[model samples]
Target chain A: MKRSERLVDMTKYLMERPHTLISLPFFAQRYGAAKSSISEDLAILKHTLAGNQDGILETVAGAAGGVRYIPYLGKEHAENYLEDLAVRVQDPKRILPGNFVYLSDILGNPQDLRQIGKLIATRYAYAKVDTVMTIETKGIALAQAVARYLNVPFVTARKRSKVTEGATVSVNYISSSLDRVSKMELPTRALPKGSNVLIVDDFMKGGGTLTGMQELVHEFEGSITGICVLCEADFDKEKLVSDYLSLIKIDQINQQEKVISSKPGNFLTETDFSRF
Target chain B: MKRSERLVDMTKYLMERPHTLISLPFFAQRYGAAKSSISEDLAILKHTLAGNQDGILETVAGAAGGVRYIPYLGKEHAENYLEDLAVRVQDPKRILPGNFVYLSDILGNPQDLRQIGKLIATRYAYAKVDTVMTIETKGIALAQAVARYLNVPFVTARKRSKVTEGATVSVNYISSSLDRVSKMELPTRALPKGSNVLIVDDFMKGGGTLTGMQELVHEFEGSITGICVLCEADFDKEKLVSDYLSLIKIDQINQQEKVISSKPGNFLTETDFSRF
Candidate 1:
């Protein structure tokens, strides 16, 4: 293939499999081009990605090393995405009957999920996460998104038992929203013991659900690498867990006044983005 | 930017926003290049995508015209993926005591989900789907995968009610394994009326759960665009619904005898890949 054609295919191939090592010989064989040409094509890709500040292509020095693509967004890109996301979360029309914010729109949005996932993945790009964990229903999307970027499998904990799962390990935590004890469970074989796990959820109300996930992680003998939530309800009385990060914090939800206030949470400051 | 750089950015931009239309002039202005240059860049991208048969750079003419990136996979890609998937699923260790297949690995694997999602998305790329729907538990992963590629929000129907979702629409489904009627529900606002929804599941034993999803779609006055499953148990009883696609089919599984057989299902044959 010509250099231009090889560059097009090489860019697409690397982007699809981020953080994966690819050898020049493999690309040469795939493109039927010389290793020198393949190397040159990669240099162009690396320069293009670096110039855009949207991605990174790292070159490895040895026979086993060639190039690795990292799906990254520069500081400006991250800030712009969070600011727009916070604004969208602040829409008053999202307020539901019992003061619940209707965030299904954001949760379902592909672009939003992509940024959120990449942001979280960027935070843990070096964490060496074995698995991503989240509770059922709402947290599934956030968990799956982060897991995708990290190239790891995400395990979901369910509140109820299903025969389909075969066997499960259950954990109980205080449900502050309902003022009762709630139980969540994970399939027995979902996570290998002693593996590193990153916990994620859509909303953190008093952090009760997060604690449940923590307990479940402990049961599996896996240590919690980190915990993050898309939204945190600051107006709620008392939190069940700390040392967690939120992308957006909802400080006030005054249904009577039809008001809501939010901003990008501590995720930015909490994240160690100095890896690159 | 030169055509080389423009081609790289255009590929990334179009791939990131699948199924969305982008005008040629928009790119022309973004690159500070002439319309003719932008057109050449798009042609390169379209040709690259077409040659691989991995995606389609759809061009629409007239006043509302530009290009759309459609996620697609070739027959060989689908066959190779599903064949390997079937072999993995046939592992005796994956066979649970109650004839259940341990699919947690597949559900958690990002690589597998990406391929599966892209393949299913290709089938319905032109179907104008408004949403993707699935039942709780394993089906969540499949639904999210397809939804991610389709660039649509996926709604999960819970087997039981949770306090988070406030109000819901419930439907009755025959629990084939339990041989009893069971109920499933989705949030009242999860699906808007008149949506064209594609239903997906992790496994289909008797297609009972899919029927329930169809019923919920009916209650909302929405239409079922299509139905698909990751695995279908051909050895099981006749299905409750027809017109569904399965990525893999388990023809036999006798735990006591320690035997299993499977292959890719009818999806490859039934899907219309004429667009590429």
Candidate 2:
């Protein structure tokens, strides 16, 4: 293939498989080009991605050297997205009964998920996350998105046991929002032993569900590398878990007054965007 | 930017926002290049994607015209993937109690989800699907994957009502697997009226859950564009629903014998790959 054609195909291939290394010989054989030419094409790809501040192409040097695409977004991009997300969360129409803010629409949106996933993956690009874990229903999407960017598998925990999944390990945690004890379970074979897990969720009220997931990870002998959520109820009761990250923090949600207020969470300040 | 850099950036940009039209003027302004140069750059991208039969760059004419990227795979590509998926499904260890096969690993895999999502999107690329719908738990990942490729929002139907989602529309259908009437609900604001929804699920036995989703679509005053599933049990009893596409068909699973059999479904014969 010609250089221009190779560049287009190469960019699409690398973007699809982020955090994966592709050896020079493999690209050379695929494009029927010389190793030196493949290196030059990669140089162009690296420079363009860096110039755009949307992704990073890391070149590993050694006998096992190759190129790895890291989904790294610039600070400006992350800040602008969080600002827009916070504004969107502040819509009065989203106020629900009992001070709950309706965010299902945002959670279901693909563009928003892509941005959110990219932002979260940027934070843990170097954290060595073996797998992304989330609970049933809402958190699955976020988990899948982050897993895609990180090039890893994701596992979901279920609240109710089902016969389809075979054997499962159950964990009980306080349902802080409901003021009751609830149980969540994960399939025995879903996760491997000693895996590094990154927990994610759509909404966190008292961090009960997050706690449940953490316990499940422990049961599997996996370590919790990080915890993140799309939205956190900052004004609610005390949280069970600290040291977690959130994209948006809801300060107030007046149901009768039909008002809501929110701001970007600590994810912005906690994340280091200087790599771009 | 040079032609090589422009090609790389343009390919990445278009791939990120599938099914969304981007006019030449927009690309010209973003790259600070002439309109003719932008057109040439897109031409290179279109040709490269076509050569690989991986994607389709469609051009619109006249005013309000631009280019849209359709995630498409050739017939051979789809066939090869499904064949490999069937072989993977044939693993004897996946056989579980009650003749059920464990597939959470495949469902949770990002790479497998990407291929499944792209194949399904190819089938519905021109179907004008307004939204993707699936039941809670297992189907959420498949729904999100397809929705992302189609650039549409996905809605999940919960098995039980939750206070977090506010008001919901409930539907009752016979659970073929359990042989009991079960209820599923979707938030009132989750889906809009008059949408063309594509229902998807992770597994189908009697297809009772799919029927419930179909009924829910009707209840919302929307149309059912199509139904797709990742796996279906062929040796099971009569199905409650037909006219659906499945990626893999499990013919039999004997837990005691440690045997499982499967093959590609009708999706391959149903899809037309000539567009590439």
Candidate 3:
């Protein structure tokens, strides 16, 4: 193939398999091009991605060395997207009963998920995340999006057990929203033992749900690499977990006044973007 | 930017926003190049995608003209993936009590989701799908995958009502597995009226869950563009719905013998890949 054609295919291939190492010889064989020429094509891809500031193509130097595409959005891109997302979150129409902000629209949106996923994946890009875990219903989208970019499998925890999942390990946590204890469980075989898990959810009210996931990870004999939520209710009474990151923070939701206020969460500051 | 850089960025840009059009002038301005140069870049990208048969770069002509990256996998790719998937499905270890097959591993896999999403997207690439819908829990991953490729929003139908989702429109369907009448619903504001929706799910036994989603779509005054499931049990007594596509067919599940059999479904024969 020609250099132009090789560059286009290479970009698509790498983008699809983020955080995956591709050997130079593999590319060379795929394109039927010389190793030196393959190197030149990769250089163009790496330089193009770096110039756009939306992706990174890291080159590993050794016998096993190859290019790995890291879905790292630049700091500026992160700030702009989060700010816009926060503004969208401030819409008064999103206010639900009992101070719950409706985020189904954002969670269901592909464009939003892409950015949110990339942003979260960028934060944990360097972390040893063997699996992405989320509680089912809403958090599945966010978890899948992040998993797509990180090139890792994502498992969903369910509030109720189903016949399809065989056996499960359950965990109980305080349901702050309902003021009761709620149980969530994961399939026993869904996650491997001693795996590093990144917990994610759509919303956090007092961080109860997050703790449930943390405990479930422990039940599987796995470690929690990090925890992140798409939205956090900042005004909610004392949180159950503190070492977590959120993309958007909902500071206020006035029921009677029909008003809402939000801002970008700690994900902007807590994430280390210096590697790019 | 040079032609090489433009091709790389253009490929990534179009791949990210599938089914969306980008005018020549937009690319021209973004790359600081002439319209003719941008046209040439798109041609190279188009030819490359066409050659691979895994994607389609559709070009529109005249005043409102641009390119659309359609995530269409070729017939061979579809056949190969589904065959390998069927083999994996035949694993006796995947059999659960009540003759249910364990697919949590495949559903959680990013690679499998990517292939499944592209295959379904390929089938519905030319359809007018306003949104993708699925029943909650397992189907969310499949819905999200297809929605990402189609660049549309996906809404989940819940088995039980939740406070997070505002008001919901509920429907009753026969749960063949439990042999009981079950209810499922979607939030009132989740899907807009008069949408052309594509329904997807992870598994189908007697097609009960799919029909429930179909009814929910109708309740929202939306039209069903297409219905698809990742796996369908052929041994089931009868199906509730007839007009649907499945990627894999589970022929038998012998609980006593601990044996399972599967094969590719109707997707390969039903889809039209002649456009390429």
Best of the candidates, DockQ: 3
Interface RMSD of 2: 1.1
Better of 1 and 3 by DockQ: 3
lDDT measured at residue A38 in model 3 versus the true structure, 0 to 100 = 92
- lDDT of predicted model 3: 0.92
Candidate 3 residue lDDT tens string, A1-276: 999999999999999899999999999999999999999998988888888788889999899999999999989999999999999999988898988888888999999999999999999999999999999878999999999999999999998867678888998998888889999999898999999999999999888889999999999889999999999999979999989999999999998898899999999999988876
Chain A TM-score for model 1, please? 0.95
lDDT of each: 0.85, 0.92, 0.92
Error of 2 at B29 (Å): 1.0
TM-scores for every candidate against the unseen true structure? 0.96, 0.99, 0.99
> Candidate 3, which segments miss by more than 4 Å at Cα?
none
Q: Could you give candidate 3's per-residue lDDT for residues B94-187 as a string of tens digits?
A: 9999888999889888999999999999999999999999888888999999999999999988888777778889999988878899999888
Quote the lDDT for A84 in model 1: 84
Model 3 chain B lowest lDDT segment of ten: B159-168
CA deviation > 4 Å runs, candidate 2: none
